[model samples]
Target: MKYEKALLLVLAVTMTIITELDLLPQIHRMGFYCGDPKLSHDYIGDTVTARYLLLISFFIPFLILIDKNLYQSSFSTYLLMYITFIIGYCLCISSVNFFKILFGEPRPHFFDTCKPVEALKCTPGSYVSTFTCTNSDLRRARDSTKSFPSGHSALSTFSAGFVLLYISNKASDWKRIVQVLCIAWILSCTVTRIFDHRHHWWDVLSGIVYGMGLAVITLR
Candidate 1:
């Protein structure tokens, strides 16, 4: 079991690195109409940066686990549980990145990021796929095209959902408060995605469902 878990961890790490490097298959070149209000939002910035979200997602549950098990469980047992949590997190992110590339749904701030060269020439309501971005930042331009399943939503939901399930299995008096906090975090992530013009309602919904599903599977 230890060897199997180690191998799985390695695979998850490799997949995550590949996704972060955008080394997977090319994102689908989805087209958009000229003057589409949906894609016309300005890309201000993330309310919760990716790094911040990841840190909280990891440490919050980790702290909770440690607090709950500090007196009841052995160090080795705690380590094993934390490893499983990591595995679930890695799997969730890798899968979400794959879907983002596959669907290639435009971000709400697509026009701002992409700045399609043909924006001025394309007819209204007509699809325009053949165009180049005017944005000098190549990485941001590339990311603008792959916003199907919000990674933020998926990661946030997965962490909170997983922790909630963990809390539910325990008989501690503080479990209810922790559960409420988890739910609030997930909701906050969802609201920020929309308000920040990062994802559509459907994209957030899909990611939430995806994350929740993985959370249940991980706990099982």
Candidate 2:
């Protein structure tokens, strides 16, 4: 069981590193016009930062799991449940990153982040398939291409969905309230992605669906 946990953790970390390191071929190239308004949004900072999101995802469910299982189950049983939760999260995140790399949909702030060198050379109304980013920050420029299936939305929804399912199995007075809050949290995460100019509506929708699907599978 410890080995299984270690393997899942390693797999998640490896997937993230591969995505961050640009190891995979970003074959799905999306074209854009010289002055496309869709890609011209400003890069404001995230409303829910990665650090906070991670903490919320991990600790909230962890505390709930502890409360739910500690009284009735052995320490090993509780530990296994925690491990399963971590594994589900790892898989959810890894899958999201895989889709982001595979699709290569440009973010709303793509132009701002990438600064393609051929923006001036290409005709204003013509579609451009070939261009190079002149941005000094190569990492940011690379990330500008990976906007499909918002990670924030997917992971947030997954965490909430997981908790909702976990608690729903057992009856409690607070279950309905927590379930409502989870749904609301998912909606907020979806909306913020759009307002942040980080994702389109469809991107967020797909993420939510994916998250919920995985959550159901994990808990089942």
User: RMSD in angstroms, all models?
Assistant: 1.8, 2.6
**TM-score (all chains, Cα) for each model:** 0.93, 0.86
- In terms of TM-score, the best-performing candidate is 1
Residue pairs clashing, model 2: none
Question: What are the per-residue Cα lDDT tens digits for candidate 1 across 7-100?
Answer: 9899988888899778887657788989999999999899989988888888767646536543245767667777888899999989998988
Superposed model 1: Cα runs more than 4 Å off:
66-73
The lDDT of model 2 is 0.78
How do the residues 18-103 of candidate 2 rate in per-residue lDDT, one tens digit apiece? 76456877767687887888898998868877677767777656545435442135667666666677778878877787788788
**Candidate 2 global TM-score:** 0.86
The per-candidate count of clashes, in order, stands at: 0, 0
| Over 4 Å off, model 2 | 1-10, 20-25, 63-76
Poorest 10 consecutive residues of model 2 by lDDT?
A: 63-72
